[model samples]
Target: MQNFDYMTPTRLIFGKESIVKLPEVMRSLGKRVLLTYGGGSIKKIGLYDRVNELLKDFEIFELPGIQPNPKYDPSVLDGVRMCKENQIDVILAVGGGSVLDCSKAIAAGAKYDGDPWDLITYKVKAQAALPIVDVLTLAATGSEYDCGGVISRTETNDKVGYMDPLLFPVCSILDPVYTFTVSKKQTAAGCADAMNHTIEQYFVADSTLLNDGFCESMLKSLMVNATKCIENPEDYTARAEMMLCCTYGCNGILSLGNSYSGWPCHGIEHALSAYYDITHGEGLAIITPRWMRHILNEKTIDRFVKYGINVFGIDATLPKQEIAEKAIDATYAFFESINIPMHLREVGIDESRIDEMAHHIAVNEGLENAYAPLTEEDIKKILIESL
Candidate 1:
């Protein structure tokens, strides 16, 4: 096992009726609140009214309409302006990962004088940030439990993953009830996103048996529960378990004491989503099997064999190479079974920008050092295969 240090200070209030405790948790952080969310889904679900009623005693400033992929422009910039102008002491992010992600950047930007992009790109270290509290409505991204987010700059075609210890939410309120109304499309996409998160951590060169077991179990749980969620969105047990798996997905718990795999799929998908504005998880689903095929070789056969046998229950007596190839096929089949568009062309992403995207990912994502190193040509091939 690799030497490591870990700390998770985010207090989790999980289960039914957890949102009722939001008022008490928010008081400890501050009385002045900046409420952030995406489109009016929270309102449609009555969570918007409920949150307002709970925080009625506190001063509230609202920043709504934060989009998927979490734009760095108006959302982050406006959030920072709101925090500064209102003297907001804390942020209450009330939607999915994108809302919390935008809130995280805003929290840090509120305390910085220069452009927030500097802090996001690590050009400047953040000295302080307004605290954050979150109510998770989507079972994806794990932003509530981790101090990192992916922010997109539409103009620049850049989607950067930003992490800072200061951005971890002080508290996260999770209730499976809030997710009952999520569309099947998003539910499946969430499953794909969380599954990829575990796969990224599991495929590393060096890892502990304990961490490997954790990753395998997480992948199975996501697949099982996501299927249930698609069939019956109101299945509490399914939603709850799926929600917990995603919450743990990107929080470092699954990767601790393991060597980094460089998260090359995410590196590749970032460019796809940045250029074409595709759904994040759907892009991952489309690219992962292709990347798997491209990187499979004598060096990686063992890892894939184990993944096939353990996670998918493929017969262990099969030849190692066959098991690996079957495992990759099974992965593609799962995403397709869940009705994820499974192809770049299906998602309206043609080959027009494949070269540009491959070059961008090679230059910006540092995938050359990934577990299975991907060069510009290698990435281009993967992109072509994805199409």
Candidate 2:
């Protein structure tokens, strides 16, 4: 195994009644809270009122309307402003990954005087940040447990993933019952997103039996439970398993000692989501398999073979190259089976911006020396094939 250092400081409170622990976690965090949510869905599901009732003792300020591919504007900017003006102490993210992502940005921004984008883009690093506590209402993106968040700047079509240990929530409360109401579209998208997270790590140029088993188990659990979730949204077992899968995704547990993947699919999908405001997870699902087909070669066949045998139970005796190709095809078919749109045009993206997307990715994501090398031309080919 490669030499490495690892740390996961976030406290996880998970179970059926974990929401009851919110007030105590908030007590350790701060007194005045900056409460963040998206589009009022949490309110529709009565979570807003529930949180209000539970936190009746604490002072709260609201930052609503955080969107998917959560933007640096309104959510982060307004949140920072609220923090500065009202002297908000800690941030409480109360919706899905987008809300938590925006809250994370706001937490970092609230403690800095510079533009948050500067921090998000790594133009400046955060010296300190407001404490964050989250109540997860969705099972994707894993922002609850990780120190990274993807934020968009519409003016520049830039969607950047920002990471700083300072951004991790001091604690997260996960009650899977909260996700029982998520629409199937989002349910499938969430599963696909979480699955892609593990696959990205699993496909890297490094190997360790530790992460390999974790990746395979996480992948199979997500796929099987996600399908069960689609068939029955209120199945607590499926929702719990999926929520756990997403939590494991961005938290670095599945990638310890693995080589850097450059997260090429995420880099490419960021362009689509940032430009068109597509659902981040759905965009990833649509682009992933196509990228897989584009990148498969003799150099990368074994990882695919192992993934097929371990995760999907493909026959091990098949030709190795054929196993790899079938694995790629099975991946594409899984997204299709979940009703995720499998092509860019189907999602309103087209070839016109493949060159632009490629150039932007080259400039932003630094995919030149990724695990599988991808030049701008290579990125364009992948994008074109995805289309």
Candidate 3:
């Protein structure tokens, strides 16, 4: 175990009808509200009307169309301008991770005197931020529970994960009913995203048994519930479990005393999504197994063995190497079963920018310091294998 200091201050109002609490939560935070969302899906599902009805007393302003892989230029900039102009007291992010992520950046940027990109790129640290409250409609990225958000600069083809404790939402309303209408594609991708988050933390150099158990159980739960979700999107029990699992994914709670894995999969996948505008979770699913295969060696075999045996129930009596390989195969198969494109080419990425992406990832994401220390060449090879 490693020395650590941890706290998750995001108050989770979970279960059915949790959105009803949004009014009281927002009232406690402030009066002037910046309501953020993406693509008007909330309106289609009637959540938009319910939220408006509940918060009819508050001074509300709208910042709609916050896209996935949230952008910095218009969304973040416009949000900061709105906050500054309106003297916005709190932000109500009412969509998936993208909206909440954009809201988080806006929350931090509203208080800063400099460009929001500077804060996102870590050119400067944040001192204070506007309070954030979220109603989560997607069970991915875990942004509602974590202080980090991945934002993209489309012109520059740069996606950066920004982290600051002040960026954590003050409260999150997690009603699985909100996710009942999630498309199968998104639900599977969300499960892949959550699984990748856990595996990133699990495949570290040093970890406590407790943390390992947590990771393994979470992985199994996500896999099982994800399949259930794909089969029947209206299965509230599975949806609820998967939602909670993903909420716990990136919140720093599961890996409390574990050594850092440097989250190399995310580090690499960021480039794919940034460059190709690919779906974040689909890109992660495509990269994860290949990265696992590339990093599997004598030093990492034990971790793979445990993951195989515990999570996938691969026969523990099998040869160690066989077990590890089977585990990796099982991972790839799981993603394939969920209908995630298992190749970069399938997602419209090809060799043309493989070198550029590898260099970008090596330079920007610092994968050289990852648990297995992938070099630029290693990244290229993984990308090729993924293709």
Candidate 4:
């Protein structure tokens, strides 16, 4: 096992009535609340009215329309302005991970005197941040439980995953009931996102059996429950389990004592999503198997063999190479089965900028030092193969 230190201070209030505690939770943090959200899904789901009723005593200011791939320009900038102007006490992030992510950036940016981009890019470390309390409505990204958030600077075509302990939500209300209405496409994409989170950590160079088992079981649960969710979106039991799995996905609990895999898949997919504004999870699903095929070799065959046997239950007696290849195929088939676009073109991404994206990823993502190190040419080949 690799040496490591871990801490998760976010208090999780899970289950049906979790949101009822929102008022009390925010009470300790502040009276002036910055309510952040994406689109108007909360209103459609009645969560908007419910939250307004619950926190009626507090002064609330709104920052709406935080998009997926959470942009830094307007959302983060506007949020910071709102916080500073209103002297916001705490942020109440509604909607999904993108809202929470933008809120995180706003939280940190609210306290920093420099450009918020400075803090996000690590040009300056955040000394303090506005407290955040989230009511999670999506099961993807795990931003509800993790301190890190991916923020994009669209002008630069950069999506940076920023992490500072100060950015962790003080409290997260995870009421699975709220997720029962999530659409079928989002449900599958969410499962793909969480599955990739586990796979990134599981594929590391050094890991314990305990962590591996945690990942394997979570992947199995996500697959089974995702199928259930697609068939019946209102299946409370499936939604609850999948929600919990995603909540744990990026919080480091699943990868404790595991060597860093450099999260190569995420590294590559970040560029794809940043440049194309594609669905983050769908981009990952499209790139993952191709990355797997490109990286498979004698040095990494053992992990693939174990993944194939333990997770997918491939015949143990098969040759290691065959097992690895089958494992990759099984991964591809699973995403296809879930109805995610398996090819880049299917998602409206084409080869026009493949070379540009490859070079950009090579320079910015630092994937040259990944678990299965990839060069610029290697990345280009993978992108081409993905197409």
Q: How far is candidate 4 from the true structure (C-alpha RMSD, Å)?
A: 0.7
Off by over 4 Å in 2: none
Instruction: Summarize candidate 3's per-residue lDDT along 1-387 as a digit string, tens digits.
Output: 899988899899999998877877887788999999999799999999999999989999999999999999899999999999999999999999999999999999999998889999989999999999999999988999999898999999999999999998999999998999999999999999999999999999999999999999999999999999989999999999999999999998889989998899999999999998899999999999999999999999999999999999999999999999999999999999999989989989989999999999989988888899999999999999999
Model 2 agreement with the true structure over 17-93: per-residue lDDT tens digits: 89988888888767898899888779888889999999999999998888888887767889999999999999999
Q: Report, for every candidate in turn, its global Cα lDDT versus the true structure.
A: 0.96, 0.89, 0.94, 0.94
Worst 10 residues of 1 by lDDT: 271-280
Which pairs clash inside model 3? none
- Give RMSD to native, each candidate: 0.5, 1.0, 0.7, 0.7
Candidate 1 error regions (>4 Å): none
Cα error of candidate 1 at position 249, Å: 0.5
By TM-score, how accurate is candidate 4? 0.99
Angstrom error at residue 316, model 4? 0.2
RMSD (CA, angstroms), candidate 1: 0.5
TM-score for each prediction?
0.99, 0.98, 0.99, 0.99
**Winner on lDDT (2 vs 4):** 4
lDDT of 2 at 24: 85
Q: Tell how far residue 318 is off in model 2, in angstroms.
A: 1.0
Model 2 clashing-pair count = 0
Worst 10 residues of 3 by lDDT: 20-29
